[model samples]
Target: MKKTCLNINATHGGFSLIEIMISAFILALGLLGLAGMQSTAVKSTIEIQQRSLANSLITDITERMQLNRLWLSGAGNSYSIDSLTDANLSIPNCIGSGGVFVNCSGEDIKNNDLYEWKQKFTGAEVNASTNGENGLVEADACIAVSPASGSDGELVQIVISWFSTVKSKDAAANAGATDLTNTCGTANAHRRQLSVETYISKSS
Candidate 1:
């Protein structure tokens, strides 16, 4: 009788239950990380949008101020704040048959033709309590203006403030989120301000 070699293979090269569970756990953790990243991306997008809007608001005010520097500086008394009315701000129904202008609506003056110039930034509800026709710090231009002689300049300060949807605690909890809080405990509000002491030379 020829004794044939009988091979009895006992090598189990497959993964054990513990190893499988561990791999599954690692994969699940990776997926959760991806989800968290997606959430962060969404929040970041919102922050960018808010930032852009704030920038646009500031630009709008500055551009208008520059364009109407005469009025901004009370040049013919045509552009004075006293003349600012809903009609001049281009508010519909504010002008009657005589085209006589009246006091600007609180909302109309606060926007500074931003509502009429562009529809994109119009109707944006700001922190009404903190923001108005006056500057962000509530400085009235009419009161603040004190013409410096021989300077031939009008020092105008333009301020833009908006409420950012980004929450503080949430931002702290998630490092990826934007923190919009200011030192004055004015959380969720970002203010951009600049003072342009432009000299309105008689030539120009």
Candidate 2:
């Protein structure tokens, strides 16, 4: 009688080492994707918030100019500012005693409006928050008042420029695109701008 011996093994039961390795790799990739999405979402949120704030500030200054239309009229009248430092940062006193807002001359109001705008742009209104500044980054603004050709009124163009986290210089290079088109701020690829034009009727 010849007896043949058969060797059978049943030690390994569940998943193999290679299978576990592959699953770990896939899980890591999924987590990485989730982190990337979160980063992109944060950037987009900041972009929207900054743009909204810029528009609000523009509206504020334009309204102030409207109130001072009489002083803003005539071909000789102008307030074209190249940047924030292009003019003095001083503000005229318009508040009477007891924190009351007294009647300020058109010129005085204009000066005060610009001063306050700069402050807000620099995050002066920001309260104590450990997160970040409450205003635009590296803000630069220009308020150009172009008197109409025929003395109809003045054209107020508000251009606010700041550093945009949404688009970086490196990202712009990667996309082969220019981020800045207007001649405001540093006019660099990292700069973003918000502008609006409004016509203020001549009151005088």
Candidate 3:
């Protein structure tokens, strides 16, 4: 009997170098996409936070105006001889109050609050100085009590404004500064408005 030699070999199933490299590249691409998405989300979250702060600031002022209706009306009447300026109205003690500030007296509206509000916000500036032309110069509320003639009501006008971190032409020019509306226009610009009107419901 002649003996025959038999040889047997097994092929191992494994990924080739090229396949491994390609898979790594694909994974890298996916990771990069995820990173980009995360970055975008962070930016959006920051923007929302800024806007929320601004809204809160505005709301606080509105409430003050409503609560201190007497102060507003009194100031309007007393300052009738003079005009409302940008400095006349301001957010009070932004830093001291941790964002809560109020002024019972009209004098406090001038600089006390503005000074504090500026310190609270990382990058914010206020320019309120009542000393020029009248007709809602730069005040959040220009309570212009209408002539009673014979009525017992008064008209109050309120105008409010706030600085925006984004949306501004000058902001585009200056990377450091930002505008809220990113557009230029009295109506479109991000601004704090003043609402003024008269009410006969109460007497001063």
Candidate 4:
């Protein structure tokens, strides 16, 4: 009898359960890292928008002050204000019944400017009732005019302060937050502010 060679087929190699689990874990880690990155991007974008809004607000108030230089220069640095929500602020009627422009005294124009500026922050200008809808969180503004040091005119300081949803990177900043930072609002880790200063003279 001739001996016939018997052949056995080798088993195919495939991923084991351990290998599959490891691959899944690595994939999950990568997905989690991607999600974290997206969240940080959103937060940073919001912070940047808020910063831009703050700058715009400060610039607006500064321009208004410059327009009233005749009044501000003669006021002896008395054109100052704090807390945009101050109930004492009186809104003046600068528009006539026919939606016509009316000439107003410098004082009336100043009051109107303040009221309109507050409306911008209060969302009323945007047709929304929410406060701080101008990309600010619990925002308030201050206009402080004082004698300019080594200058021939009054120094006008316009500051816009807001609550920041983002936490501060410096622990000491959060701890040391105060009204001193913005001259209007007390801040914690979430405090942010923008300010501009210019010298105004009556002669100019």
TM-scores, one per candidate: 0.51, 0.79, 0.48, 0.83
lDDT of 1 by residue, 27-90 (tens): 9999999999999899777667655654655466555555544444444322223211122344
State, as a TM-score between 0 and 1, how close model 3 is to the true structure. 0.48
Please tell me which model should have the higher lDDT, number 1 or number 3: 1
Comparison by TM-score, 3 against 4, better one: 4
Sliding window of 10 residues with minimal summed lDDT for model 2: 170-179
Model 2: clashing residue pairs? none
Task: Tell me, by lDDT, which candidate is best.
Answer: 2
| Predictions in order: lDDT | 0.42, 0.73, 0.42, 0.70
Tens digits of per-residue lDDT, candidate 4, 16-110, equal 99999999999999999999999999988988988888787777777787787777656553557867766366566776666455888778777
The residue-level lDDT of candidate 1 at 189 comes to 25
lDDT of 3 by residue, 1-204 (tens): 999998989889999999999999999999999999998788666556655654554454344434434544552432221222233445544324465444335545534433343333323233234333322222231223354566543443323343333454432233223232222213323343322233432244
**Which regions of candidate 2 are displaced past 4 Å?**
1-12, 97-99, 127-132, 168-181
Q: After superposition, how far is residue 87 of candidate 4 from its true place, in Å?
A: 4.6
